[model samples]
Target: MSSHRPPPVPPRQVFTDPVHFLAFGFGSGLSPKAPGTAGTVAAIPLYLLLSGLPLWGYLLATLVVIVAGIWLCGESSRRLGVHDHPGIVWDEFAGFLVTMIAAPAGWIWVLVGFVLFRIFDVLKPWPIGWVDRRVGGGTGIVVDDLLAGVYALVVLQLLAWWWQVLMATA
Candidate 1:
């Protein structure tokens, strides 16, 4: 067993490197505890900003982020000497955006999507867990979260639809 652990990463490093800044979710990933959750929290503002665009526009932007996240995450991890380091959270940003895609418009929906995305991300059910374990490089870093987002999106849409039906009946 190698006792040599990687040196502690300086928060300033994220600012110094553009890729690290983004991969760290604009520094939100530097949180001392539960940086993944912090990264997801940082994504909320971005979701609000992008939610106003047309569906296609929103999707296009998300697609761009998702594709770029692979490189951003990979390069940052390589520089940091850690593969998918907890602080490299661009994947969480892309994943949260995926969860909020077409989500019902309201604070409640936002909260629900956030909770659902967090749950799925932390749980890493089935194929998500498989990908997380078997995949490598940036794709490995981002794909698991993407799958989690898809799971959250499905559940969120279902709950929104059911709620609408209930309101109509009421």
Candidate 2:
């Protein structure tokens, strides 16, 4: 058995590096424990602001984030000389945005989306796990999470529909 462990990706220099600043989810990814979870939690307020926008506007903004995330996340990983460091969580921000598209109207569902997104992200089932391993650079880093977001989005929509049905019945 080869005990080959890649060296740890160092913490971000949030103040010194702009790429790090964004990739770290404005510092939420810098948390010593569960940085990914921290980044997901930090996304809530941003999601709130974005949710107020018209659906098109929200989707447009999310599109911009995803497109730009490819570069931002890639460069940050390169600068750190690491591939998809746990601390580089711009993907999480972008992923959470993806999960929120057409989400139900309420903080409750937002929380639900967060949990679902996290589950998909952490679990990396199916193509998510495949992409995470097969892809490289920023595309790999962000795409995996983006896929997870898509999965979460589907589950969230289903939940919304179920909720609507329940409310209608009541």
Candidate 3:
């Protein structure tokens, strides 16, 4: 096998592949810097829409996106010939969605979740980093973000509880 590797194609080439299109988070992933953050910002509107649903409905929607993301991420990775390209950010969308599952109904909660998810994703503490390195394919692309979302979810819940306590005591 040749050890030679071709140069990366321009990020905009994703238009040629529908799976890459979604994996790029509708071009938010094309941002020159912090594509993951850009993708998370894009996810804000989607989260708002889904949050309006009943708890089970929101959860079901999250589940559907995660399932779709696996295929989209995997295919995108293959088509681009790059594993976990920084620009392939469907993972960010799914991660933010995971963070907001059954979240308290408030814009503040949404903001908190966003901040927390980004932190965990960037930091990749413990098992999050472990999965990011050891896993492969679409599962690898999306799983780390999902784990970040779970960590953010727990922190958000704790903050919500504390806020309620403060409100009651005030």
Candidate 4:
């Protein structure tokens, strides 16, 4: 057998490695408590940064992240020997992006989207919860959040439309 030894696992840095990077929303997931909340909270600045881009640009970035997130999350989970740990939250970022599509481009809508997305994400209603339970690996990690984003998007759009109708009727 060869004499070479495997490299040592590095000590956890504040914001290095896929697990930490993704778990914290690139650092937001590092909060002492409620990492998911922190991850969602961390998404705001990114949202602000991306939301300013043209819709196409935002859409492209979201797609890239979602694709990359599958690998990152999967690799991290395999290394850690865990499934969908709380800190792996690139999924949340993708979900938030989904929630914003065709959404009102304003802080109010963003806040509403954030809250709604979190609720749907945590509750995992119907198909969202179903996918989370049935799927495995990194694909499972990201799919539930994607569905949550879709749910949030639909609900927010309907609410906006209803508000508009009410305003017109008034």
Candidate 5:
């Protein structure tokens, strides 16, 4: 393997390519500060649109994003001549959507999902860290975040259940 690395890509250039545009999380990844967080934040609007769909429809949409994201992210990485560049945040987009799956109908839940997803994605507990270290290419890039989303999903679901029980008692 070559140790040579490509020069940093300009933010404006992200818009020039459709794949890069998407892989950059619609430009959210271009943020100089905390691109991953920005990318996850960018996902919220899309999630709002997605949340309106039927459960099956939502799942299908999420699946499409995840599958397409692998390609989008991989291609962008190649073009950038980097591995998992910070600006490639389509993974974050897919991961956040995964966290919000079957979430309760409320902005509060959206907030919870966002926070939880961010935490796991950032912390990369357990197998999340394992995958990030060992995996390669786009699958490697996105899989870690996907696992983070799963972790968040479990916690989010449990919190929702507990909140429901508490409400019932009230």
Candidate 6:
């Protein structure tokens, strides 16, 4: 039998045209290096825009983003024949949303959350790293960032609480 290899797939599109710009996180994934970092950076404006919403509204929106991200990331990966390509970054958007949920409503908190989430995401400590390696497809792409978001949330919450306690005691 003659060896037959599949033709090379084209480079993935960044935004699927203009209509899907927001869905693709504003082409942040197209960054030349550290695309995940770029994706997370792209989320800052969105976080600022949504941070003004009422607490319940913010939480609801975050939930929607997370649920939708799985499908979007998966679909793009399917088209590209790659698993978790850097250019597919709906996960970063969802993770940023999760990080902002219940955070103190201020620029300082926002910056802190952003830094913390990026750190944990890049570091991928413990089960986060494990999940990143073992899981496949869209679920794998998103789950690690989701866990990083959780870690950031927990740490920030504890820090906020401790700050409050310290201030009250002082």
* Strongest candidate by TM-score: 1
lDDT of 3 at 17: 65
Assess every candidate by TM-score: 0.95, 0.93, 0.92, 0.86, 0.95, 0.85
lDDT of all the models against the reference?
Answer: 0.94, 0.89, 0.90, 0.80, 0.94, 0.80
Candidate no. 4 TM-score: 0.86
Model 1 has how many clashing residue pairs? 0
Alpha carbon deviation, residue 46, candidate 2 (Å): 1.5
lDDT of 6 by residue, 1-170 (tens): 98553333323545455322433567777666777788888888888888889999999888888888877787767766767766677899999889878888777888889889999998999999999999987788889989999999998888778978999999
Counting clashing residue pairs in each candidate, in order, gives 0, 0, 0, 2, 0, 0
- Candidate 1 vs candidate 3, TM-score winner: 1
Worst 10 residues of 5 by lDDT: 3-12
lDDT per residue as tens, model 1, 27-138: 9989888889999999999999999999999999999999999999999999888998888889999999999999989999999999999999999999999999999999
Q: List the residue pairs that clash in candidate 4.
A: 23-87, 24-29
The positional error of residue 57 in candidate 4, measured at the CA in angstroms, is 1.9
Per-residue error (Å), model 1, residue 76: 0.3
* Candidate 2 per-residue lDDT over residues 20-108, each given as its tens digit: 88888888877878889999888888889889999999999898888888999999889888788888888998999999999978889
Q: Tell me how many residue pairs clash in candidate 4.
A: 2
Q: What does candidate 3's lDDT look like per residue over 71-170, in tens digits?
A: 9999888887888888888999999999998789988898899999999999999999999999999999999999999999999999999999999999
Better of 4 and 5 by TM-score: 5
**Pairs of residues clashing in candidate 6:** none
Regions of model 6 farther than 4 Å from truth? 1-12, 18-24
Task: For candidate 5, write residues 59-135 as lDDT tens digits.
Answer: 99999999999999989998888899988999999999999999999999999999999999999999999999999
How much lDDT does candidate 3 score? 0.90
